[model samples]
Target chain A: MLKFTCPYCGIEASETELAAGGEAHLKRYGPGSSEQDFEGYLFLRKNPKGVHLERWRHVMGCGKWFLAARHTATLEVFGTYSAQTHEPPAEIIENIRAKFPEWQA
Target chain B: MSDPRSAVGGAVYEGYVTVKDSGAHGMITLRGDHAELAEAVKAAVGSGMPTQRRIEGGLGGGAAWASPDELLLFCDYADAAGALEKARKSLEGNHFLVADVSDARAVFALEGSGIRDLLAKLCPADLSPEALPHGEFRRSHLGQVAAAFWLESEETATVICFRSVAPYVYDLLSEAVKGGPIGIF
Candidate 1:
């Protein structure tokens, strides 16, 4: 069982509590998209080791959006934020604030 | 068993709903003398909660210390009822509430790479080990299933809920795995 911290719920999700995301962010267009586009999105993929940004749609609780960055080697999640508002978590605030204080606002 | 009310989704939440008119497992709700029940449960289940929040990054099945007197135990779906009965019969009439819930709820586990990233999308809790850590359990909604989840590590979680709503819960999770937003039912 894995413990997952939901950026939206602000609580730890027991391995039984949450569903896992795809390899980072792999987005596929709806049926409206042409076959080539769908096939390209599904088959072509990249495996990142560090600072990879991905989208995870929480289907269980708050029903919100999130972006997550984690270290593939250490399993250390750098930070997560609500994608709906683009509000990053505090853990990321300090890391980015030092570089761009103006962006903090 | 493919009962009309139960689901053994590939993982815990993958197929969240299960129903059993006759339970294959036993449930023992130990109240009051929660301490004694916990001790017995410890002996029955594998062991107690893990010492470190992050162990090997693969979160294990789930054993937790809820309240001072309350501890929730998880076992094989088939073994749950028997385990509960064993505990109940062992301490008969002891000041505890032991009831067989083997048929009442469905159990599932969600584990894999990017688990935290997936959870951050559904829950509003701190799932990070540094923050929420391990050895914890919370009753919250996973798209309205009103689930109970235990965080074992960075890539594992256990989810259990009423058998009646197992399909909806499983559906929510399935939809998410496909990269769709969760919805309330």
Candidate 2:
């Protein structure tokens, strides 16, 4: 079972206490956008085998949502950050870059 | 005026630990900037504002941090209205929301040496002495419902959950303690 430290509450919560929210940093394509962009936004997702970012909610703890970066294959967690930001924080990006030199943000 | 009634009607259960309804407790859900809330909380409950995941005073009259921008203030059930009024008046010009939620919630007292073991069975939080020491407040799931709890001392804890789920939560606690101490703690 995966354990994640909630960035908001500073508690290490198990997978049972959290609700996964698919991918993170998703850019919504609203009205006036092309059908292709909307389709990609709604259905397409990056299935990287390496470092990936995802959104998780501490449903049983502080009930706050946060973002986490981890390796999909190795299950090595890079870091967790507040959900208020649109992109990963500089520190998390640096941490990920340090481990996976060829990985792009 | 009508007398207030607790959600469980003062239910009590005896097993490895004692589970009893703590009766009606005044609770207010306060949400806003913490800086503005500090003054409001002090004015309402005569206690300092709580830090992250902590309670500032005793359960009789204290403030517990519920979230980044929210606090759960406790007081006497009879004084809920007055306390809420004071909080609102103190935060009149600030962007804040405060409400008396005493009737909307249920409180239970768990007493015994197996308090941690009983709670550890239901909650995902680390209930060890070092992790959830006295005065530390935790909001998490108890069984399937959302619940919040804090240690009153080495052997006592106060747990609160929605009034609608009082029976469910009470049963969960009562059953969890029926088999005697787990001795994991």
Candidate 3:
């Protein structure tokens, strides 16, 4: 059983509490403006089998929206942070920074 | 001390237990101004205000910070006086509400590889490692009463339900341990 640390509720839940909502941070092709964009949305996935920042829901329990960074192959989850949380868990951000050194707004 | 926590499945296997208390410890409530109270508490105890994980070691005692403004502290059993005095001396007259919770609830710690599986059978909340990593806790219905699971490790968790429901939870786990199958994870 895999677990994700919910930053808000502060409980580690089994994968059962969470719902994978599709590729996290998914970018639409021109804001739902074209059919090709819709098709791309429906059929495309980088599926990079690496650490990914994706949307998760505490569906069966907390019923909250959160972001989770996970290692797909091993399912080594670092943590989960609320979507509304701006400060973001420092440890996770650091890991992200290490992976994508140039990551910036 | 094994954390004064009763492990269900009775040490039958490595981490499984046969029977155990649902809530093993007492939880106290404190209401005060966060800034002044927290600082004074820190000075008095050595460390207070649990910021991470379950069971925060206090400046003068111990507690589990259940929420941002809520904490569960105790001064009963092994170090009752020490814990109580520590809390009293530090913020006694500084406008705080302290109460004894020795019998308000009971607690239990569920350990071993089969924890996720057994809890899944008893609890509706997700106990999967991917969904809940660790250092997680929540209060919800365990069968009929309000129970909580404090994730201590990937394989171990502390369960807390009311004293009234203690027997039921204990029976539930005991049956799960003996009558149920094992969780491979």
Candidate 4:
């Protein structure tokens, strides 16, 4: 089972204690946006083989949500950050870039 | 008002490990800034917040850390209302949430030779003394139900789970010891 560290509680929780929230940092297309933009926002998702960012809630533990960066193929987790932030922190971006130089955060 | 009955009473198993009902206790889920809430909590519950993941005992009862900003205060069910009122008074202007969830959970105590290994079967959290130690609280699961557990001493532990599923958890634990030190619960 995958292990995750909760940014709010500082506990390293097993995957069972956490709930995956699929994809992070999605821009909302509401009200004035084009239909295609709204459709993309609602239905489109990136399923990259390497270096992906996602959201997770510590459901059985602290009940706080957080973000995690991981590789879909290798299962190597880069790091976890607080859910309160609007963007990924610079150090995390740097770590991902170091591993996949062509990738952008 | 009616008194709450114990979810699972009497000893269900007589083996190397024993399980007993701890009865219903007054429980509060308090959340706020730890440093700020510590004083108010001490005034209200007769004990201060435990240092991250620990449990502290005092004249009134015991306080267990549920998370970084949360503390679970447990006392006699009869005294819970009064304790919550006192804590609210002490916490006056702070940004906090104090919820009395006394009936939400049923508590049980497990003690014996292989209780740690038995707990390891059900919970993913490390139960080794060096890692968990005494007085440390961990929130995890007992099968599919959510549970919070802590070590009272070397051979003893207290487990709290949702009231509705207390019997199911007890039965699962009972089945674990029937086969003489099974690998999984």
Candidate 5:
């Protein structure tokens, strides 16, 4: 029953209308990299209990992909941003830091 | 040339709400810079570019914001090729993609006093007047299929979905209409 505000279309979409894309912001390691780096890039995930950043596709809404920062345990969303960026916006990072001072990116 | 046929062969159903196939609309999927696309769209459809998640114009011809960089431009079925040609010609020398997708989609017109209530049964979008006012287009799912809809007025809406799912969507709408209004609106 989770709901997300689509950053692209500005619609509050229910979970049923979206598709989860696992964790976000991993530095992709390609063919030239070491096996360990590639494996980590493909399989390793933070799976953090709190303050998680994930990718979501508004499949049914705007059909655009976006990144969301939220607390895993509380399901409190910090913010959503365009998927084209390499990292979360500074404002969202600042907001998360304000709420969880000890948390690190 | 063979006459174009719609997916549902122009089906119609009447219950608490009326659902009918809006046969053979010309749809163009345009992808590029919004500002540039706007000018090309005007040339193709003679309608202004739609704002985010909104549709500008009517069932005859118009543009709907499909995404930040994409638009769904629709016009008369016979004019699809001409419209696509116009858009491409206008966007020449620019990085853009335009295609005539008229046959790939199916459109349905829903009309009744219970339009909102009937749509709410299948779509997760907020169909309230304030949220989905006239001209505001919403790209959402109907039941489990990808669908988009826009309200033409308080009791009228136009829906579009993949042509492959036309029969499925028609059935869904017909069944929902038969369920009678929940009176939520």
Candidate 6:
């Protein structure tokens, strides 16, 4: 089981204690946006194999939602941060860049 | 109107480990910065936020740190409503959320030499004295259900779960205590 550190509770919660909330930092394409943009917002996803950001809720624990930056292939969690912000933290991006020179966040 | 009965009827199962429904206790979920709510929290529960994952108890009952910004306060049912109101009033004008969850969950008290062993079967927590000493709290899953449990002492633990599944929690505990070679004896 993949263990996730909850940013709010400061606990390394087990997978059962968390709920996956799909990809993070998705821009909403509401009314007035192109149909293509709206459809992409509704259905599109970036299922990258490495260095991914995800939204997870510590439902069984603190009942708070947070974001995590992880390597999908290795399951190595770079870091976790509060969900109140719209973008990933700079340090998280830097860590990813140091490990993966080819990718950009 | 009649007083409410415990969700598990206060059942007591005698085994290597004894599991008892502690009955309906007053449980409140409070969220705010401890630095900002320190005085108000102390006034409400006789204490402030507990030291991370620890529980503190006094005349007003116990308070456990639920998260960095949240605390769970527990007390006798008779004093719950008044304490909540006073706490709310104390923190008036502050950005906070205080919710009374007394009816939302049930408390089960277990004590005995084998209590820790029993927990090993149900939860993934370490449960060792060094890993989870007295007054430690953790929110985890018990089998398939969500539960919040704490080590009140070396030989005692208090588990809180959603009231709707109190029976399930009780049954799971009972089964664990009465099924194995180390348990049923």
Q: Whose TM-score is greatest here?
A: 5
- Candidate 3 local lDDT, B137-184, one digit each (tens): 554456655666666666667776666666677777767777565564
B53-118: candidate 2 lDDT, tens digit per residue: 999986678899988889999999999999999999999988999999999999999999899999
* Model 3, runs deviating above 4 Å: A1-105, B1-18, B22-27, B33-48, B52-54, B57-61, B74-78, B182-185
Residues A8-100 of candidate 5: C-alpha lDDT, one tens digit per residue: 889999989999999988898998999999999989889889999999999887788999999999999999998988988999999999999
DockQ sort, best first: 5, 2, 4, 6, 3, 1
Q: Which number leads on DockQ?
A: 5
Candidate 1 C-alpha error for residue A35, in Å: 76
Residue-level lDDT tens digits of model 4 in B24-141: 7889888888888877677767786788878898213878888777889987898888888877888889999888889888888888878778888777776777777878788888
- Report the lDDT of model 1 for residue A93: 56
lDDT of 1 by residue, B1-185 (tens): 66433454443323222211222233334444444554555554544432222111121223443333444555566566566766666667677765656677776666665555555565555555555555455556776556666666656665666778877766666666667323221
TM-score of chain A of each: 0.53, 0.95, 0.70, 0.93, 0.95, 0.94
lDDT of candidate 4 over A1-105, digit per residue (tens): 688778877778888888999999999999999999999999999989888999999989878889999898887888899887888999889888888889886
The Cα local distance difference test for each model comes to 0.53, 0.90, 0.60, 0.82, 0.91, 0.83
Candidate 1 lDDT score at position B48: 48
Clashing pairs in 2: none
- Interface RMSD of structure candidate 5 (Å): 0.9
What's the C-alpha lDDT at position B59 in model 5? 62
Note the residue pairs that clash in candidate 4. none
- What range of 10 consecutive residues in model 2 chain A has the weakest lDDT sum? A1-10
Encode model 2's per-residue lDDT on A1-105: one tens digit a residue.
588899887888888789999899999999999999999999999998989999999987788999999888988898999999999999999999898787787
Candidate 3 C-alpha RMSD relative to the actual structure = 10.7
How well is each residue in B1-185 modelled by candidate 5, as lDDT tens digits?
Answer: 67999999989999878999988889999999897887798899999989888899976889999899999998998999999999999999999999989889999999888989999999899998889888898988999899999888877889999999999999999999989899998
For model 1, residues A1-105, the per-residue Cα lDDT tens digits are: 334556655655554445556544455577899998888787866566544455565545433456765555566555666564444567775664554455422
Candidate 3 interface RMS: 4.8
